[model samples]
Target: MKHPVTPDGRYFVVRGRLWRMSNPKLDETQRSKLTNRLMSARRAVRAAKTANDQSAEAAAHRAVDDAKRVLGERGPVWWNDGSPDLNRHLAKNTPYAEWYGQIGRSRPGGT
Candidate 1:
């Protein structure tokens, strides 16, 4: 399912938490390549877990980390606005609280 992105495009909200978005400045081709690599690494992690191979899992995890870092998802904040990175922070506790609250209120049966 698609998640809601913040107005500044710096993050997307999932389960009421903010997750940093990738660098929007990245060219489409480069983004696609990095995304593909990230997916492959994720699959490798699952395969290693299913095979009960701890070493392989560790290596796969590293690969995943590397892919994410390069994609600007897990390392430094991609925005250059000097804003503090709020990745993984609960939306209700962050600057997005008011906006997130409006989202819930706009949805049917939302409280």
Candidate 2:
């Protein structure tokens, strides 16, 4: 949960991993509007309780998804680099496997 944004604020580091994040395609006004809406949706999701709130939460989640897409954090990537998206995999299992293992002892139970 420690997501520290990089100096340029274009990426955030979590658990020793840097995740690409940027939304240059969105103007300040538009981005702020979407961001506010997304925050409201997230709050709604957290406060959900009644049966109707389930559907409300789902709608809120959709709003968040849309906002993220517009912000270039979801859908297609913001960068033009040809490298494959490795965000979904752990460094220990991806191309960085060897490097990660070299810095630490093996995990318990062979994981």
Candidate 3:
């Protein structure tokens, strides 16, 4: 049977919708480190807002973005395949639209 997720576990398919999941290969230590960085950036965003630090806010945003990119939530896809990213796309609106409705019958959420 065909698998919904990619071989790397970085993306999953649901009713033809591609959802980006964190890279499963990430080690515990690395995951923890990145999580900490993300949290710190989040805090910095709040602090910068209160302190009116525009530069600090921009830097924190970049840090958060970098952490997310590393975590496989945003930025370039983890997959090296040339297939286009379907993130945030609806099955009915994408190339898979033809079969997405049929697959919906077995879709977990059935939406």
Candidate 4:
């Protein structure tokens, strides 16, 4: 998805690539809502990082939930590819780029 970097620069991908949807438009309310959702996503990640045990899964889930809450059905749907599976091997076996590529292959056009 395209995401704006700042007030001046145009939107870009989360992995820092230039977006195909250049100068894409978004209303102020939508921008505000998206900003809030991204903030929640960050917090969820932080919580998961701080968690020490199996309970960290709860924090990860919360992060995904908050992301969905802000992004709405689009965000939640985006977050649901793996469902409840939190396999650590998913990390160890593939780089983020590779993993995202696989996910994209599994769900074309981001579903």
Candidate achieving the largest TM-score: 1
Summarize candidate 4's per-residue lDDT along 31-102 as a digit string, tens digits: 576667667766766766677544765766676665544443233222324543222223223333454455
Measured over all alpha carbons after superposition, the RMSD of each candidate to the real structure, in angstroms, is 1.6, 5.7, 5.0, 11.9
Please list the residue runs of candidate 1 whose C-alpha ends up more than 4 Å from where it truly belongs after superposition.
108-111
* lDDT, candidates in the order shown: 0.88, 0.63, 0.74, 0.44
Q: What is candidate 4's TM-score against the reference?
A: 0.34
Candidate 3's residue-wise lDDT over 23-105, tens digit each?
A: 66789899889989989999999999999999999998999989989987788776677867777786577666555566566
Q: Clashing residue pairs in candidate 2, if any?
A: none
34-97, model 1: which lDDT tens digit per residue? Answer: 9999999999999999999999999999999998888888898887789998999998998988
Score residue 72 of candidate 4 by CA lDDT.
36
Off by over 4 Å in 4: 1-23, 53-111
Task: Give the number of colliding residue pairs in candidate 2.
Answer: 0
Q: Report lDDT (Cα) of residue 92, candidate 2.
A: 55
TM-score of every candidate: 0.93, 0.62, 0.62, 0.34
Which one wins by TM-score: 1 or 3?
A: 1
